[model samples]
Target chain A: MTPSALLCQFRLIGLCRKWCSSRAFTCQAAVNQLRREQGATALAGRVDRFGGITVDLADVGLPKDISETAFADLLTDSLGRWKSEGKVAVWLRVPIAMSRCAGAAAARGFTFHHAQERHAVLSLWMGAGESKLPGFATHQIGVAGAVVDESNGKVLVVQDKNKTKNAWKFPGGLSDPGENIVTAVREVLEETGIRSEFRSLLSIRQQHNHPGAFGMSDIYVICRLRPLSYDIHFCTRECERCEWLSLAELARTADTTPITSRVARLLLHGLERGFESIDLAMEELPAVYSGMFYQLYHRQIPSS
Target chain B: MTPSALLCQFRLIGLCRKWCSSRAFTCQAAVNQLRREQGATALAGRVDRFGGITVDLADVGLPKDISETAFADLLTDSLGRWKSEGKVAVWLRVPIAMSRCAGAAAARGFTFHHAQERHAVLSLWMGAGESKLPGFATHQIGVAGAVVDESNGKVLVVQDKNKTKNAWKFPGGLSDPGENIVTAVREVLEETGIRSEFRSLLSIRQQHNHPGAFGMSDIYVICRLRPLSYDIHFCTRECERCEWLSLAELARTADTTPITSRVARLLLHGLERGFESIDLAMEELPAVYSGMFYQLYHRQIPSS
Candidate 1:
């Protein structure tokens, strides 16, 4: 029989086993004995650094025709062995082709970790107390550049073509994956066609359930940027208008976003009482992970 | 034949059709005719408010045994039609049972949008230019509370039992999904057994590629909190030590993380110059989404 036909037969058997839960143990034992006789590979897995067991079903050489009942039996037996071995967590990856097994895992208390192209990962904490697993990223970061020409006392701003309000705001966009705060410089260059260099992070706005972020929280960072070239050449596709407005006038204008007006006032304060008063200076520090580093932004400590 | 056996037959036919690209068109036409004769349900979808199409395969009533080739053909035909209809984006959700269709969709330029337990979502921009679809969340928010005792000029701090370095730091933890900065209050209470109320956001630290965050970026927010009760009943499992240390001493000490030390000085600055000199006060504003509100953190605007 073709593999697909065999799969059908196994599904039928699995359906029957589901209705006869009392006989499941005997059926599972028989299947296991048959598998041993056929020299079929046992479910394979590896131990993670955290003493957790990770099983990728696609790479485990599962029989294409294995029934859900048999798979569940194998999983239960494995969990019992792993628990005795003091495994802390179990990470299970179920390929799309063998997705029927996900239900079995879920019934055994597995919950989703994250999903990718060809598979879905489920996790369970087998250790004592609450699960210590860190969750998936749940916020999007948007970096905007407030390009100020100190010589002229003007700042570059734009009105997006797509937005209904068309309120003047800083030229900005979402930060790409693995991008740094310097992404604000690129966003400014793209939207207004002006080159700038990142100086210091000025302000951060944290909002939850952002409409544009597809129901995720948003972190908007405004950076103080020093303009390199002062010519205006904005992208017509993204912005309706772009200009260099007087910083003082922008701060008092009613025709801009609240954030823009607020940042304008902040820039005014920074200008009058030194940028150090408002700047969250970036400092690179070695991360806990050896040979790796991360950027830390905080108030600059005055040199003693 | 059972649905599973029919699925197998579909796979065999799809495999054959894949090898015969020249005859694939004719085969697809025949399949379409067969579908019409059998009165199979047409692919169902809805147009979102943004003029994008969303097709959930689980709810679309696809044939139980539809071949991959046929699914691909249908998707291609749909794309052409939707493009002519001026659809901006196409959101396709494929359930695990029909994940074989994912490859066919990907070949036509569909990329992963996000994934969930039962289905994975793929997206394509059918508009004039680049896809405007917002990306999935890519940063995790960690909120920490620095609880200050105004009477004694002391701050609450802790050293984690699990970390190699038992450095003094504010008691805090990861923000739960949809939780506000006020989560810091809860985390402080849980870790140090001190009840506190959130006063103002003090500082934000943005870091990328956090080791503990599964390769995602992290945003850490620190909030100033006032102590409600000052009894030290720390959770021994999570902390090695907890104490109320002098604010001035923590700022001058070398036995703490750089961030903690910097925040200590910031708090000291606040003590001397007033918190308005450093605080990012929270303001609740109506979000663009009707009936929704979001919290904005920025320098307080002085009442005119």
Candidate 2:
């Protein structure tokens, strides 16, 4: 890293330390509260974020305690927070022993975030010791989409071509070679010409349900954007149609699929709040653009 | 990149293609706009981002426009955009004819981002009447801090070690070799035992204004984080006493630095946003981590 970038990072760390130092006392207070009620399992998962669901690796059940209901609440809360303050995704691994209970989650139709490779090894290491754990590698990637036009209570939607005709979707794609999710969103826009802005992170839709898709799709912090201009373009003939449609119109669209429900809800709710554009620092343009470039020119440009 | 990772990426590519097909029409709209805008040079001088700033062969200034307002705007925008984008520096060339104009930027109090490297290079072409543009490399970096408490509002703060213990600062040190801004942040946190969440990316402070310290300082993305837990881990004592301070109480302690202005504003806004955490795919982690580790520890650690 360049000296300037290094220095910038150092500054953030310092703040984290300082923040932790002050919160140390509070953590101590909560430690006791957590220890009393949740036992070791509850205590382990005590880092409760309001409107944010915390997966308790200890329980590992389908339709886990944090279900669609909890997810919706958390998502709403998160979207509000993300509007002004951008959102971030943090991926961490729980030790196999700590995460073993999560394995049972599959029976309830719950899937571990990185179940195939990372979680697989973790489960084996914890349940069957080192000998039984299959050796493989895994990585978690987060991709986000920015809703550029949510004017007239209608969200801008892109109809993908590779899939069924008339199906509505978001104007975003997958991560690129050597790029991250934020970049992926930017790339999709630059290619698709849907001037978008990030709104709130939608959901981390893993590949379990869509075995056809494979692995996991870490949908990033979604956002609502105001397209400066409506003229759409395709760097390549990737998508069939990009349009601005009202939430009700989208619902009534004959081609709307069940998959679009989440996006529909997000857009409808965002429209009600009257989304605002977030200030983007010029310096940040490079990363955003480059990230998009990586996604477009070099990334696994997403399909229908 | 490993073979498995490559395969996984291919799968993702297929998914992207399908997504693109579904949204082809929307993409065409954006494509038209892009075609119209292509003739305009407003997008000129813009760098190509390939994980870092890349000065496209076409955009790097030719001699005539070097000292023009457009030139300055391009440079300023580039600097501002890249800096905010979290890039350490930008690489470009000053056409040999524009060598005379180099002083123009310097005269305007604009300094090269990096002082250690040769500022410019002269190149000779093999063809007749053909001359190569001279080259220059400059770099910049920023540092950020997040102050948080367990209650999600407290963080440890300190007086600058270099300063006379009057200017309150985060307990972070300069970045080391082979590290990104995030790496720098991690290093500082490891040394300080402070856990931080990335918040709003702050300004990329000018390095010329290094204060009493040896190196320059820029305002990075500073944030407010909730401390999770703390341990007395040390990477050698690098600070004076560290204290947890509430955001409300920071100003009461010492006059906050101009660098901290954004942080203070963010705190006052009562915005709760999480900082960005990098997402690397699970199947690709070993190789990615290994690449970094190899550079730093190849000689130290024996390959299995």
Candidate 3:
């Protein structure tokens, strides 16, 4: 069947599932449960399968009018509208006086299998409210890297000429244009000639404006690597030299320019963790958003 | 009223309206008649009351596939499980994948409203897929600009010490730290001594390693201005001289530079459009992303 026809059929089946799955009492009980979970934490937690923490916005002492569940609904509703057609959308709630828009979102049709009882109550704070530093436009491409062949808690490093003060650092660069970020991880292996496989992204450092003779050098995504082949040889002209050093001894080595304290700390932690996936969460999100989680889940708009 | 109670009330009112406004009809004939009266195109073209455009994915040659919609459901379900307090909801269907994502968007959700009706189909194409480029994290803090005085179809321009080797240009500079963008806009006004107000973002231009320049410079939301006052005063530090040139004379001016081509073209079109509100859509977006129209609306994961 044509792709369109298949979709139509699938939507039909999904509608049936939604219909069959719900009972009024169960939905109502679910709403009550959501109410009990309300708190002042922010709701900007990652929506991954593994449980992530939701901050209580009120905990931060921001506007505390909205219930956590209600705030969740607002965000969820916005997402529904934004990502429907591959289009990215974002919503800003500003004071009516400052903003030209006075009207609230129009009600779209939604099929509710279950009614969510809770709502968000946070009021829009005025005068330089929360910063959505990362707008919706930045596309996040997944990337992975590794630290290889550790002998006595030491991994690998390379000295480079281009960076500030010609410091020793991990041998990696950005993913090429149209290159899969994951694939780029492997390229590090090909260039360095040291057999290394993928590891989790250890930390992300955004250097808005790097301090040096230069202005802004851009942010770097640091990764942890594991060794696949031991003996190392420089296969590319990108770096000057390579070596593996223990964290304790590495600090004394000036091969790498003085890494940021944060980077240094992460490196130490990675050594302790011994290569594991690390979850990165925005620690700054307010908690009232957490209270709004329920509304985000169950509110449905009409199907076009 | 309690925040949850407010939401419950809104939902209740919506439910009553649904039941009272339309009688339930199960027959295919009734569905067909409704479709005919509304016309699929008309129905599809309805502007989302909340925000954004809604297009039937089926109408646009895209469909919701079984695997993708099911996956979408999984996301909602996953979000619900992670939050525990409230479910993550989204506006379903209102397919927007074929368009650019911008403006007011919340989340992406897909659902099938009826079993008998065609199941919505989602066609998943391979690869990283096209995504919108993120603007600067700093730029999102809002922009400030001036609306210059009525120039009678003539706008003020300055010959720059750097680029003036060829053309006339708007007088402005990078925003300083701790100052709001609007403050920067006002600063430009004081330095230039020309009254103006912000109109809209004109465009974002990033030229890497241009013929003469070494680094990238971002363009700003162009402001329109009234001649609060005018002076022939030259800021010897940056500008050589200020002049108000008519659009007709801009091309013939000996001092016009290569970059002036873009400025001229923009001015010509903007002037033709009566210079009402700057066409932010045209300015802020690349030509490639302009064609897309619809987006995903709202999605909900039933609290199971």
Candidate 4:
């Protein structure tokens, strides 16, 4: 595929001398350069493109009353017009969901190629050369806190026991069965004895089937929090130590994980912007508990 | 770094001889096996962790009456307590905005290590051993369309002219400054002549300082559209040819780009979900234009 473009062009141009003699016109940029230099030659000749007209029959709604015979007949009628238009190859892709379309295609000359779990690939070659079909390689809300000592410019992380990879991360885990605010407060409290007030929603990270998440898609929402207490008691189940790290100290050895480090960088940016806050106020709980999160935490906001 | 954990653990247990001689404990699971076998040996050693604290002073509201000397004194006092607690390192990360804090840190023994555009790293080592601080490696939105011939399970892409790589992509460029609806329609019109109606938002892609984007942060908002006409006359400035490809055809050869294929897969998933639509009539737009966008470029609908 890398050489397909220039090779296809060179075969049309009939100037594959450099290509055949030295096998040196390998680089794509160089091939494009040669194509540019020989623009006149390219203009003089018609492109010998891999000739094909693929009829994709997946998800398309066919006439509800059209018989399979009529579908085959319609395709047969189109083949003549396609040949008139100088298309020498025909590729018909039949989606797994469209068994009727696959039947109609099989009634014509199209043959089976390969398939993914989602869709099946089929092809009908009207030309003499080979056509390579595309290969199919297919491969939660997570919330964490950027619990900063806004008074002292320190971020809190717990020393993790999970094989000492970076050994530390922002202590909060995925949101439990509660609102983001409640989860933030509960996680921060559970992991570190420090009490924190949620300030605003900070950042959202999306991962699609990431291995770190056991091949699950998850969204991680990082919230900004203001610390209220000083003493920290580490969660014995998850971490070995609890640390209050400076933004600079975290940046120096911030290899605990990429997402955490990314969150740290953003936290610094927020400090630079003077920490503009997002408000969350309404909650059904008592003021002592509900007052902890940002003003917008308890209510849903409209999408922009 | 992958094997460093097990190697470091082995060093603590005086099992370096067996590890180095055998060279068999290579996989992570194997190392975990060794750890399980020598669980008691692991328990016998006291864990040694590099200890440090960083003071971030950027956005934190320092008392208006306190002088830099008092802040320095506070940090110095913490140093003695940290040392008494067996902490061997002290780190102070000063944000670029916190110049005054950097001055106070300089008054102490904190030396500059490295810096990112947003923050500076500085550290003080009180330990008996070497302290290696972590350096900073710092590293946008884009919108693209997954134009599907829903009846035929085909996707539409244009052969790009810029390079040989991923020559095909859904006919799209960056959106202009107007509403995403306007940008979607306009960019689509400019690239391909097929008139389409904006259905709803498909995906939001954020490209931050990407090389293709001239190192600017941008958000790419993709919108799904229903094609009204079939003929496509490609824009000469950007692409060479316009094509309608089936999912199987794309799967067989859809190497236009990773993101494009990802969108295609998502589009297939969307089709499986019967292509659920997102509403947008409530946007702050004149009823005439927004109405036209949704209603075949000619009509209006009563909003629910």
Best by DockQ: 1
Point out the higher-scoring one by TM-score: 1 or 4: 1
lDDT of 1 by residue, B196-222 (tens): 998888877767777767677888888
Report the C-alpha lDDT of model 2 over B200-288, residue by residue, as the tens digit: 22322222223222222222323233445555344443555556667666634555564443344445344244222111111111222
Report the number of the highest-lDDT candidate: 1
TM-score of each: 0.79, 0.31, 0.24, 0.28
C-alpha displacement of B72 in model 4, angstroms?
A: 33
Model 3 TM-score on a 0 to 1 scale: 0.24
**RMSD to true structure for each model, in Å:** 8.1, 30.8, 24.4, 27.5
Who is ahead in TM-score, 2 or 3?
A: 2
Candidate 3 local Cα displacement, residue B289, angstroms = 28
State the lDDT of candidate 4 residue by residue for A1-304, as single tens digits. 3355434433433332332222222333333443346441211112234565655554233332233344455566566666666777665544333323434555565654433223334455665566443221111235566788767789988877655354567777653222333367668888888888877655444334444332333345566778888788878876787889887677567456655665566567556555542222223322211233212221112222
DockQ of each model vs. true complex: 0.25, 0.01, 0.02, 0.01
Model 4, B67-171: lDDT tens per residue? 334455555655566667776666554443332344455556665543322444455677775754432111112345656778988877777766556466777
Chain A alone, TM-score per model: 0.79, 0.41, 0.39, 0.45
Q: Model 3 misses residue A54 by how many Å?
A: 50
Candidate 3 per-residue C-alpha lDDT over B98-146 given as tens digits, one digit per residue, 9 for 90 to 100: 1111011112322221110111111111113442222121111122233
Clashes of 2: 100
Sort candidate 1 into its docking category.
acceptable
Evaluate model 3 with DockQ and give the value: 0.02
lDDT of 3 by residue, A159-263 (tens): 664445656566665543233333435656755677665544344322323232012223234555667776777654567677775665565565554332234
